[model samples]
Target: MQPLLSSYSSSSSLTIFLVSLLLVGDHGGARIILPANVTVPAVIAFGDSIMDQGANNNLNTLAKANFAPYGKDSVAGIPTGRFSNNRTPADMLVEQMGIKEFMPAYLDPSLDDKELLTGVSFASAGSGFDPQTPNLLGVLSFADQLDQFKEYIEKLKGIVGEERTQYILTNSLFLVVAGSNDLANTYFTIGIRKLQYDIPSYSNLMVSSASNFIKDIYKLGARRIVVFNAPPVGCLPLQRTLSGNEHRMCAEKHNKAAQLYNNKLQAELKHLHNTLAESKIVNIDIYKPLLAIMKNPKQYGLEVVDRGCCGTGNIEVAILCNRLLPTCLDASKYLFWDSFHPTEKGYNILMNEVVGRHASDWF
Candidate 1:
């Protein structure tokens, strides 16, 4: 993976700050400290559009930015393939924690330029734990994204020295939002294994792909991993709308497959934490939170439960998500900002539920 990557640190924006945070105590090896005068070393990110900043914008693929109505409502008010009008949950998390405002995408061509430094966002839109899905979507795969991180590490080592760079990355928080693409694209898109394998076969593939992805990030010195699971795809407006059956909801068969994969992921990840020579992995159950929110939208203050902000949730997403082609009157009111993605408000609610102190088996 290291050799397969392009030279990192070529970006002038990449630099190391001489900073450190002390672990006052431990939560059974978990590093949970008082939110006082603490310091954040760095934040490294990976996954899909949920955490993506501008990796797709630099890529010469159909899945790109360089447009409007995309970031229109965003503070930036300019498109950047973020899948949101403003900063994502990852960004919000960073800010709330008093770290940098945003993370950097290792795949961004501007890595060599230190001006672009904050944290790195390697989550390419249309990409996922399943590498092949990106090939179909024409985006970077999870493995490739990790490869970029490895290269970034090496570059940082050269720029700031290995020990210092490792220290920073080793202590940094990692928010990995992935695996959603697999459920939405694979099982539903092409009917996974319907051509060859069955549900078990495909689910196994997903577990392996995602589990290994977490391991690789760990190898790169990430200690805190918030590995998010797939959202309630069945409850998503787009899915319900596309099925065309008002009563039809997300594909239960697909959600079942996703839940199965997540369960396996949790077990395997815990085992990895137990077995790994020197590392820790934390499971961030984005799945359950989203499910709860969907089950009780009223709890989150949402009115229109079935429809997206787009005129018709289902039709609006695939066609006018960012096309300037009449979209929903308000992006905040809808659960789904687009067909397959959530609105800034939805992500905020989603992230709110994810908030709290967690840990691995170590401090």
Candidate 2:
């Protein structure tokens, strides 16, 4: 096979062309091959909608996308509770790692032993590091997800036995993506955390919670972990609609809060990386890449950035984005699928940049 890197050019034209190729069919996008020495047994994901892959389908939460218009572009044209138009960052990450085409949800009833041996997502759509975030939405909390992960370990042991389970646990790549909801929902939108703590203090609280979660997973045998920082929460279509004023510009305050939390989270990860034994913990910044895409959609072969592809694109998400509402003609041209999540094309572009820049850090 030709080297994937050889196709990459300094200009944005090739990237845009590649994105167009990705949109041609379901799961027909370019494949990402890692270095020869790198060995990732599986790819496990945990966190909010960005990483969720049908984990919310079984749950009775309004934060679900398992309906029409959600998976209109997927292989079977059926929604799988993923927040995007098709596959999410979780699916893309695993695919990029050459593990599988899709990442199954841990709660999927139809999940088989083969999927379990590979990997599955335990992430909940509305979850955050903050406990109150998930509680407010009636979705799985971080603690609940952790418990499910423990259960998954036992099942893995049953399928592959102790030795292989341990090997998979230690060798697999674990993705922790969250914090956008905590700042976007809990702190600003709901104003629940604001009463107790200001931006600085609230950010500290979030970072502390995230650190604890990482440590907990580390204790559970996660050796190579990638913790994604909060994206620019203010730039999301929902935030722009709610807080961006009449012009619907990016909310600077929310962006600042995310930046603050990201800074602290990066520092905490560094500390954990140095202190933890045989652990590879690194923080990948999704903030800048997404923000850049939003700022210059044209550079990415995207046209609409201020709104989503669903409904009016101003504020629709999850249940609000339904069959009743109409979506954009071409989701690949839009940066967001709903108000809060990126389209599959958007995710593909972002993942390409992320993996290209940070894949080496895992080793």
**TM-scores of all candidate predictions against the true structure:** 0.82, 0.91
lDDT of each: 0.61, 0.83
TM-score leader: 2
lDDT of model 2, residue 192: 82
The lowest-lDDT stretch of 10 consecutive residues in candidate 1 is 18-27
Writing each residue's lDDT as its tens digit, candidate 1 over 1-363 gives 132113324441121000000000000111234345434566677777777777877665555434655565665577656666555776666665656555556665656535223467777776766656677656788878877888777777777787888777776777777776666555564444357657677767877887788777877788766677666665565455433254656567657777887888788778877887666577777778777767788887665556555544543332244465556677766566655666777777766656643432223
List candidate 1 stretches off by more than 4 Å: 1-39, 107-118, 357-363
Per-residue lDDT tens digits for candidate 2, residues 142-224, read 99999999999999999989999999999999999889888887888778888899999999999999999999999999999
- Residue pairs with clashing backbones, model 2: none
Report backbone clashes per prediction.
Answer: 22, 0
